[model samples]
Target: YTLMSFLFKLMEEGYELDLTYVTERIIAVSFPQDCFEETYLRNLRDVTRMLKSKHTDNYLVINLSERKQELTKMNPKTLDTGWPDFHAPPLDKICSICKAIENWLNADPLHVVVIHCRVRRNLKPPSQQHV
Candidate 1:
C-alpha cells in the first residue's frame, strides 16, 4: 500500500496527508478541509534544504472531488459471470478518463498531475501481475 503510506510521508514531511497513484501522471491526495495549519511547513523545515536540492519540473493538478457524485455514478450493467450485476465501467467513461490523462500529458512534457480525494486508500497493488 505505497499510496496509503504516502499519508505517512506527508505526515513525516510534516503535514498529515494521503495520496494514491492511479496510473501514469494521475495521483489522488487528501487534505484537511477546514484549514491548513502552518505546523506542517514547520515540520518540513529540517529537510527544506534537502528538498530544495532536487530540481524538478512543471506540473498541474486536477482534483475531481468537487465532482464526486458524477465521478462515482455508474450505469446499471449485466456481467457475464456467476457474480450478478457486476457492471463494468462504461466505455464513454473510460474514454473521458483517457482524455483527461491525455490533456494533462499535453499540458507539459515534464508536467505531472495529482488529484485530491476525500479519503485515504489505494486502488493499485505495488506491482503488476495481480500482486
Candidate 2:
C-alpha cells in the first residue's frame, strides 16, 4: 500500500487502542523526494502526532544510502552531500523541511528518529561480481 494509505489505516485502528502504550514505528524505506514540499512535511507532522496520541512509539528512520548511490550513478552533479553553498530561494523550502524533521527528532530524547544516509561508498574487492 502507499505510505499515506498505510498511515490512514494506522490512524483508523489506533483510535480503538489504548492511548497510553501504542508503539509507532516509522521506517522510511526510501529517500525523501527531491521535490519535498511544505504540504508533505505538514502531513508527516500530523501523522506523527496522531501516532503519538494513540500511545504509539513515534519513530522516523530514513534510509537514503542506497538511493544516494543510485542517484550519483545517474548524475554526479545532482546529488550533494551537504547544504549548498549558493543561496537560492528554492533551497529555503528544502531546508525548512529538513529542519522540521530535525526538530521533531530532537523534541524528546526517548523519541527515536534516525536519519540514515551513507556519506561514502565502500570499495569492493576487484574479484567481486558486478551485475
Candidate 3:
C-alpha cells in the first residue's frame, strides 16, 4: 500500500479500491498529492471516473483541508474549504461542515458525498517531538 493508503483504509468491502465508504452514499478519499498540472488532471480524471461509477450520477464533494486555495486554482469546479491541521475546527466551522453534509444527504437519496483531507501524517505534528 502507498503511504496515503496506510493513512486511510477502505472502510467498506467491494470495488471502491483506495476510496473509503463512510456510508452507502458517502465516501472518503485522500487528497491527491500531486499538484502539478498534468498529473493532477490525470488524478482528477481517475477520481471522477470512480465517483461516477459509485454514485451513478449525482455527487457533492466536501474538501476539508487548508490547501483549498491551491486546489481551487487547479480546479475551479470544486467548492473549497479549510480546517486547521492538528487542531479541532472551531465551532462555526464544525457546524458548517455538518450542515453541508446534512444538506447534501437530504437533497437526494442517490446523491453521494465525498470528503477529502490530507493524510494523517500531514494533519498532525510528529508524536516524537515536543512543542
Candidate 4:
C-alpha cells in the first residue's frame, strides 16, 4: 500500500499501538507531503494533534524529499558509507527531530509519533532517482 493509505489503515487498526510505545523516546521519519499544512494533514483523522518541534523541522522536511540541496553538499564518492543516500541528515537536524518525537510522546497516552520520509528510489523516474 502507499504511505498515506498505510497511515489511514494504522488509524483503523485501533491501538495496534500497544503500540507507539515500541521505543521509549524518539521515532524520526520523512515528511509525507505537507505534514504541517492544514488541508493535507487534516486527512489524518487518526492523529490527535500535530505540533512543530523546532525551527529545524523545516530543513528536515526538505532533506527528506528532493534531496538535491543536501546531496549537492556531499561528495558522491564518499556518500555510501554503508548508509543510504537519505541517511545523510546532519547531526543537528537529527537531534531536532529527536526533540520533536520526544515532545509528541509526552503529549498524551494515545499520542503516536508519526515521522516519515520517502526513502526508496525503486519506482521513481530516472530524474528523481538521485535528487
Candidate 5:
C-alpha cells in the first residue's frame, strides 16, 4: 500500500517514472511479514486492477523475482535505462499480476476495503518501529 501510494503520487505529479527504482524503494521499505496477510493481498489486487483499467497501454507486469533478476544482470550505469522496444513475438502476454487484478475486478465491486494488520513478516513491536 505504501508503495502503491507512492507510485500513484508520482504518476499524478507528471514525473517520468522509473518503475524499477520505484519497485526497489517499495521492497526496501516493506516488512516481510506483510506478504502473508489476506488484506494486503486484496489491496494489491485492487490497486493492480485499478491501474490496469486506467493504464492498460503503459503498464508492464512481470514477476517480481524475475524483474529483480533482470535488474541484477544489467550494468549499474544502465540501471536507469528502460526497454522501450525489445521485441520478442512470443513474449507479449498478460502477466500474472494483471491477471490476478482482472480476476478480482471481475468477481465483484470493490468498496469498504481495509487492511488493519502489520503486513510484514519482520514486524518489530510497534515501540521499536517508525514509519
Candidate 6:
C-alpha cells in the first residue's frame, strides 16, 4: 500500500474513546483521533481529561505509533517509540521499552504509564495479522 493509504487506514471509523487497563499501572488506548487535527482539539481535550482522571498527574506515556505528534503540549510527559503499527519493535528497542517502563513504575507507585498505537487497542484483528 502507498503511504497515503496506510495513513488513511490509521484513521479508523467510528472513532471513540476506549481505554483498556492492561495492568494496574499500565493502560492501553487507541490513538486520539489524528491528534494534530485542529477540528479534533475538543476531542483531544476530553481525552486528556479522561487520562488524567485515571491517575495522578505524575504519569508517563509510551507511544508505540510512529506518529509523534501530540496534543499541543497538553499531554503528560511522553516517550515516543517511533515504532510503526502492526509490527513489533526490534529486540534492542524491546529491551529499552521494558527498561523505560520499569524505571518509571519503580520511580513512584502513582506513576501511571499509558500505552497506545495507531490501531484500535494497539492490536490488529486476527484477520489483519498477516497484512
Q: Pick the candidate with the highest lDDT.
A: 6
Error of 3 at 51 (Å): 1.4
Candidate 4 — number of clashing residue pairs? 4
Candidate 5 at 11: error in angstroms? Answer: 17
Q: Give the C-alpha miss distance for residue 76 in model 6, angstroms.
A: 4.2
Model 1 clash pairs are: none
Q: What stretches of model 3 exceed 4 Å from their correct place?
A: 1-18, 32-41, 69-77, 120-131
Model-by-model lDDT, in order?
A: 0.41, 0.41, 0.61, 0.37, 0.34, 0.66
RMSD of each: 13.0, 13.8, 7.0, 12.2, 16.8, 10.0
Per-residue lDDT for 47-131 in model 5, tens only?
4444445443233333222123322222121122112222222333434334544553355443111111122344555556686
| Clashes, model 6 | 0
lDDT for model 1 comes to: 0.41
Among all candidates shown, the one with the greatest TM-score: 6
Question: Which parts of model 5 have CA positions greater than 4 angstroms off?
Answer: 1-36, 66-131
Candidate 4 lDDT, 42-130, residue by residue in tens: 33322222212221122211123443332323212111112244447678766765676566557655454433333443355555679
* Candidate 3 to native Cα RMSD, angstroms: 7.0
| lDDT, residue 110, model 6 | 86
How much is 11 displaced in model 3, in angstroms?
15
Superposed Cα deviation of residue 23, candidate 6 (Å) = 1.9
Model 2 pairs in collision: 22-55, 22-56, 23-56, 23-57, 24-56, 24-57
lDDT of model 1 at position 25: 59
Could you arrange the candidates by lDDT from highest to lowest?
Answer: 6, 3, 1, 2, 4, 5
Give a tens-digit lDDT track for model 3, residues 26-59.
7786644433555444454556655655555577
